[model samples]
Target chain A: MFHLLDIIGTIAFAMSGALTAMNKKLDLFGVFIIAFVTAVGGGTLRDVMIGRTPVGWMLDLEYVYVICFAFVLTLVFRKKFEKLRTSLFLFDTIGLGVFTLIGLEKGISVGLHPTICIALGTMTACFGGVIRDILCAEIPVIFRKEIYATICILGGIVFFLLKSFHLDNDILYLITSLVIISVRLMAVKFKWYLPTLEKN
Target chain B: MFHLLDIIGTIAFAMSGALTAMNKKLDLFGVFIIAFVTAVGGGTLRDVMIGRTPVGWMLDLEYVYVICFAFVLTLVFRKKFEKLRTSLFLFDTIGLGVFTLIGLEKGISVGLHPTICIALGTMTACFGGVIRDILCAEIPVIFRKEIYATICILGGIVFFLLKSFHLDNDILYLITSLVIISVRLMAVKFKWYLPTLEKN
Candidate 1:
C-alpha cells in the first residue's frame, strides 16, 4: 500500500511538472527533464543529505518508468488536463502527504533527531515543487505564499506524537496521512495562505 | 596549492552570490543563504550523484568558515568590489578550472566512465552558478548563452588525452587547469556565446 502511494505521488508530481513546463513553452527535452526532476528531485536531495548513495531512483528504475509514463500522459491529454485542475490538485495533495511520510520514515530509520526528521519530511514533500519553480525561473511559490511546507511539518509532528503512544505502525501511518491530506484539503478549500515576505 | 585555489574559488563564488542577492534586495539571511549555496552547490550536487557521503562541506567546516568570511567581506566591501569586476571574473574562472579538476578526480577515484567523469567535471564547475541563477529567477546563464561549460568539457577531453600520453599527474593537472582557464578567458574576450534555442 505504501509503495502504491509512492508511485501515485511520483506520477502526480511528474505530470504537474510536465504541465508547468508546457505552459512555459519548453521544448520536448526540457519538458521531460522538468518532469523527471519534479518527481524525484526532493527524494534525491533527501537521500544525498542522509548519506544514502546511489539515490532511490538510480537504484530502482521504476521511478524513471513512471516519470516517462507521466510525461507521455500529460502530453497526450494536455488539453483535457487543463480543465482537470481540481483532480490534479487532489493528486498533488496526496503526493505531499505520502512523500512527507516517506521522508519521515527514512529519517527515523537513520535515527535522526525529531527536528531533523521534520525538516527532512518537509523537504521531501516540497523540494520538488521548489526545484520545478526554480527551473521555470520563478521565485518558489511556497516561499512566496503557501501553507504547503507548513502542512508537512505539521504531519511530521503528528507522526511522532502518535508514535509516542505505541500505536500500531499501520494505524500510525494511516492517521498521519489522513491528517496531512485533510489539512491540505481544508487549507485550499478555505484559501489559506502565508503572508509573503516583503523585499527589505 | 590545489586547496588554496579551492578556497579562492569558494570566496569568489560566495561574493558573487552575495552581490546578486543584494541586487535583488534580499535581506541579510537570504544573502547569506545565496552565498553559501553559490560557494558549495556544485560540489554538493556532484558528491551526491557520486554517492559521496556527508558531502564535502559537511565533512570540512572550513568551507562554512570561508563562506562566512566571504559573506562579511562582501557586505563590508560591496561598493569597492563593484569596481573589481575584472578580478572577480578572474577568480570565478580560476574556480571553474579548479573545481572541474576536483570533480574529475573524484569521479575517477570512484571508477566512473570517462564520459560521466567529464559530465561531473562540468557540473562541479558550473552548477553552483546554475543554482544561484535559478534561485534568482533567471534562466541559468550558462544554459542560455555563455561558453562557460564548454570550456570545462574541453578541459576534460584534454585531461584524458594527456593521460593517454602517460603524463605525470601533476603536469596533467597543471595543463588541464591552464587549458580550462585560458579557454574561458579567451571565450569571454572573444564574446563567444551559444545560440539560444528558439521556442517552438
Candidate 2:
C-alpha cells in the first residue's frame, strides 16, 4: 500500500514540476530536471538530514525509471494534462499524505525526539514543493501563511499517537495520509491560513 | 591584503545580484535576498558541506550588515550601478579569486580529501551564482560548462602543490586567486565553450 502511494506520489509530483517548467517556458532538459527534483528531492533531503546514506532514489532505481516515464508522458501528452489538473490535485494530495506518513515513520524509526521528528516529517512532506517554487521563480505558497505545513505537522502528530496505540502499519499509514489530505483540502476550501506579520 | 580582497569580492558579487534583481523588477526585500545570497551563499555551502556548524553568515553578523549595506547602496545609487557592467565584471573576477581561494583553503582545513576540496571550492565559488540564476529563472552557466568548476579545480590543485612546497600562505593564496581570475576572464573574452551533448 505504501509502495503504491510512492509511485502515485512520484507521478503527481512530476506532473506539478513539469507544469511549472511549462509555465516558465523551459526546454525539455529543464523540464526533466524539475520533474526529477520534485519526485525525489524531499525524501533525499530527509535521508541526508537523518544520516541515512545511499539516499532513497540511489537505493531504488525504480524511482528514476518512473520519473522518466512521467517526463515522457508530460512531453507526449502535454495537452491532456490540462484536463487532468483536478484529478492531478487529488493524486497530489494522496501523494502528500503518503509522503507525510513516510516521513513521520522514518523519523520515528531513526529514534529522533518526537518534536524534532514531527518537524522533520513536515519538512520532508512539504519542502519539495517549496524548492520547486523557488527554482521556478515563484514565491512558495507554503511560506506565505498557508496551512500546508500545518497539515503535515498535524498528520505527523497523529502518526505518533497511532504508533503509541500500536495500530497496524497499514491502518496507521492510511489514517495519517487521510488526515493530511482532509486537512489540506479543507484548508483550501475554507480558506484557512496562518496569520502573518503585517507588511508595511 | 586577502581581507581587503574578501570585502571587495563580496561587494562585487552583491552588486551583480542587485543588478540582476533590478533587471527582474524585484521588490526591495527580493533585491536584498539576492544580494545576500550572492555575497555569502558560497561560503555558507562550504560550511554546510564541511559540517562547520552555524554557517558563515549566521556566525558573523557583519556579513549580514555588509550585504544590507551593499543592497542599500545599489538602491540609493542606482544610476552609478547602471553604468558599471565592466566594473562589475572586474569585481566579480576578483571575487572569483577570493572566493575560490578562501573556499579551497577552508575545504582543506576541514580535512576533506584533496579532490573533494577542489570540488568543494569550485562549488563554493560558483554555486551562488548558479542558485541566483535559478532563482531568477535563468539557466545557470556553471551547469552549462566546465570553465567555472574546472578553474576552481585547477587553482585548488595549485594551492595543494604550493602548500607541499611550504610556500607562504599569502603568496600561495595570491597565486591561486590570480590563476582562477585569469582563467575566468580569458574564458569570457574568448567565448570559451565545450561541445554540447545531444538528447539521450
Per TM-score, the best of the predicted structures is 1
* Residue A145, model 2: Cα distance from true site in angstroms: 24
Q: For each candidate, what is the lDDT?
A: 0.88, 0.78
User: After superposing candidate 2, which stretches have Cα over 4 Å from the reference?
Assistant: A1-44, A47-110, A113-200
Once superposed on the true structure, which residue ranges of model 1 sit more than 4 Å away at CA? A195-200, B1-44, B51-129, B135-137, B141-200
Clashes per candidate, residues 3 or more apart or on different chains: 0, 0
Candidate 1 lDDT over B134-161, as tens digits, reads: 8887766665557888888899999999
The collision pairs in model 2 are: none
The pairs that clash in candidate 1 are none
Q: Each model's RMSD to truth, in Å? A: 6.7, 7.7
